[model samples]
Target: MNEYQPQEQLQNATLILILGILSIIGCFCYGVLGIILAIVALILAQKATKTYAQNPEMYLGYQNVKIGKILAIIGLVISVIYMCLVIWLIVTFGMEALQDQELMQQRLEEMMGQ
Candidate 1:
């Protein structure tokens, strides 16, 4: 039996990598975009990973998938942490913290005092 091989690339590999990079950068935007993009990238990468595993010789972009997965995970973790911080701030300081400087100062003083 004879097999064919060529210097080519895998499908969705570049996309996954791009999405992962974007997600990491976008994490600064309150992490909403980052989280969304990271999740999408990760889902796509999983599919690509399965495909690659099935035929390792068929793809040339597994590096993209691997790096993308790692970046996506990091982005997701950062986003989750940012989200949690937002939620904690809202819960601990209340919505007034965003609107009232006096209230914020009072809350800060109260916390410091305690």
Candidate 2:
């Protein structure tokens, strides 16, 4: 017969929690890393849940897994939104810069009597 292991369950939960936190941090600094970490966190959280199910006494582990999953999802969503916003800002500013350059050139030529 197999015995339940609280330490192993807790360890898995901790791993998931760490991945989730890393994912959130990555979201602010790097989108690709954030998405990858979030995905790994999600998978680890699921594994932790299964471990908790096998050992019903590990309530702390179960709670950690749940929190990890939530954090992972939040990180992934924020990363995507952040990337989109960055792209939008870049495009908007690029167009504005081009227009400004054209205006400046026209003014310079006018001043030069050309």
Best by TM-score: 1
Measured over all alpha carbons after superposition, the RMSD of each candidate to the real structure, in angstroms, is 1.9, 7.5
The sequence of per-residue lDDT tens digits that candidate 2 reaches over residues 1-114 is 988755544557877878888888888764778888999999888776776777667456677788889989988998888777767645645545435877656655675894
TM-score of each: 0.86, 0.64
Q: Per-residue lDDT tens digits of candidate 1, residues 1-114?
A: 876787468789999999999989888887898999999999999999898888798779999999999999999999888878877888899988857999999998998999
**Each candidate structure's count of clashing pairs:** 0, 0
Relative to the true structure, candidate 1 reaches a TM of 0.86
Error of 2 at 50 (Å): 1.9
N/CA/C clash count, model 1: 0
Any residue pairs clashing in model 1, and if so which? none
Off by over 4 Å in 2: 1-8, 58-60, 94-114
